[model samples]
Target: MTKPLPPRNDRHKSSGGFSLIELMIAITLGLMIMTGLVTIFVKNSQARTEIERNNRQLESGRYAMNLLTEDLRMAGYFSSFNPDELVISVNAPPLGPNSAPVTPAMTARPDPCDTTVANLNNTYFFHVQGYDYPYTSAALPTCISDVRTGSDVLVIRRLATCVAGPTLEAGCDALPNGAPYFQASNCFQATELARNTGSRLDYLSHFVLNTDITLATLRTISCLTSFGAPAPAADYRRYLTHIYFVANNNVGSDGIPTLKRAELGAGGYTIVPLVEGIETIQFEYGIGNTANSAKIDAYTADPNTYNACASTACLLNWLHTYSVKVNLLARNVEQSPGWTDNKVYALGLKADGSANVFPASGTYGDRYKRHAYNAVVRLDNPSGRVTP
Candidate 1:
């Protein structure tokens, strides 16, 4: 205790803390490392954002193409009934009295939005109808609005491939209410089976294709054979009519171009937005010189105009369509930083750098990137049927 107070001042001086210059140098190095880390993080974030944008554009484009292909392939698919066998029926809904037999025929073009049984009957002739931009009609259909002026509109009509119930595609009916349905008869009358003239009117008399599924008169098996017992209920499929086109906006002026469809539902035509960022859609039809032939004789954008006849009695131009070439332009959802998109997207036609009707200038002078998708899809249901 006597000498503890006089501790060595020289020892304390030898173990002194860092000098001010050394401390400043360490701070500068730390700051440099931190700045490098920050720069790396920022670059990574930007790259990730760009990748996300690109993925969305690609996925949207692919999904839209698949959707169109699926529906187009099924066009004119009326379950057991062949549309080719449907001859001119004066007893069609429009011509005859209200008690007309429900045979398939078209007095006029069937409106895609029209869910009425009368117009539904008209699907026999109007399957796979398409109207290019500069539509032959003065205006677009009443139910479809905000259709991108330059984009194409395609109408696909068919019955659901599966039975209408809680499961299966196209139908999606837990309990069918007022939705249109198509049912085929499993039982054939002796008179019908014997003649086999293959006439549609005679054949359709055994089936029911109506908007009401709750009709009690529908029968799958012969009720006459049941003899006061219950007859088996025929499986019902929802009737699907789709008008697909591109819209200028996805929501309230969100500025996102989208692929949309007017679906024939219980409440008439329900407009539904499909894939977004689909800026344009176009189509080229491959028509055959002969009816129900697979060989393509001519290709045109306006099928009706290309294959017009002196009389309206001939087959509709759309009905002769055997293949369809689809073209879609998909744009990125977000603008890239300091990016300039001056690319010409050739959706269809010759790639001579010609100006397209979609962009009007052939090139999109914007910050968002765009890609074009194309497919030549065969209309299987219509093309596969070889009239014997």
Candidate 2:
């Protein structure tokens, strides 16, 4: 009657939970998959970081190059006449009784050929000058910050291309006859006049009256007519002074080198940061022999060579400059861990035609990545007028 107890239920016993060994194998496989996924994620992150760093460096370098190229091409540009032939006529304030009719003091325009006129000590006229690497503030007064040791300084002087209409409100001020006021289409704003009171009258020589406007009605001095009948607003321009240099740091003590510009603004000279991560800058001038051929005859790093007094044979060489070769050393924003830069980069030829190399030691041995950029910007204003 016990009836074979219940034929043993073997099926239920076999279908119980998994064994310890099986659980261990499943866990091991899951851990292996997770390890692979983590490795891939880390590698992708590193790649993205590297790409971003490179792009940033490139963008900064390109911007700096473009800015300099535009300015260099326009160097020495006046509205429609050669600046060399122009002379600034400064009027002496009307004095006691009859002060000899105050024959306006006539001084030649800033000429690279004249040392006394082109000297920075004058400060009234715009002059183009440069200082090679390792120069001191004493040598370059416009360099306010501590510059990078081996970086060059470039000074550009020119007139702005923008023109103002002959409207009175556009900086034109009316004065009584013989009162001695600047007669130009555009007058400096109140702020500009206040900031540049010392040289305000001298800079007026940069402007000429509209040909249609009679010079007799404007109380203009003979200097205006010496150049030729003044042209209209379409031919007028404003003076511009720019100084370029590399600063030791960008923000605070971060050690991020930057390209800076000190421009003559409405409020006088203002220093502005243009591009960051530019560790160094160098420049070479291509002097052309206009008397013989229009092609470049020689290259020099010293702007003084173009100075009339610096080299008697090369006097007026600045006017013959056809091209400017620029070299910039660009660097990454962040340091690469465990990386060392051990290569010397050649920028260009020195003043004496010798190879100019960065880190003369043959190795920088730093964590930051660097690149050298070379560009030859033709000075259209100077070269186009060269006579073969």
**Best candidate according to TM-score:** 1
Off by over 4 Å in 1: 1-9, 12-16, 88-108, 136-138, 165-172, 190-206, 214-233, 308-315, 350-358
How far out, in Å, is residue 239 in model 1?
0.7
Q: Estimate each model's TM-score.
A: 0.82, 0.70
lDDT of 2 at 387: 40
Task: Please give, for residues 1-388, the per-residue lDDT of candidate 2 as tens digits.
Answer: 6767667767656555888999999999999999999999988998898888889898988889899889988886654543333221112311112232223222322322222312321222233456665566666653356688888888786665554323433454332222211134232333232332444433333344222233313222232345666323322334456889899988788888999987654434667989999988999988775453448887788745443334323334554567889999898979876679887889997776688899866688989888889899887765655443
Candidate 2: give the clashing pairs. none
Overall lDDT per candidate, in order of appearance? 0.71, 0.60
lDDT of 1 by residue, 56-175 (tens): 889999999999998888887877666555432232433333433443333345556666776665554456877777664455677887777678888888887677732345535453
Best model number under lDDT: 1
Lowest summed-lDDT stretch of 10 residues in model 2?
A: 88-97
| Backbone collision tally, model 1 | 0
Candidate 1: the clashing residue pairs are none
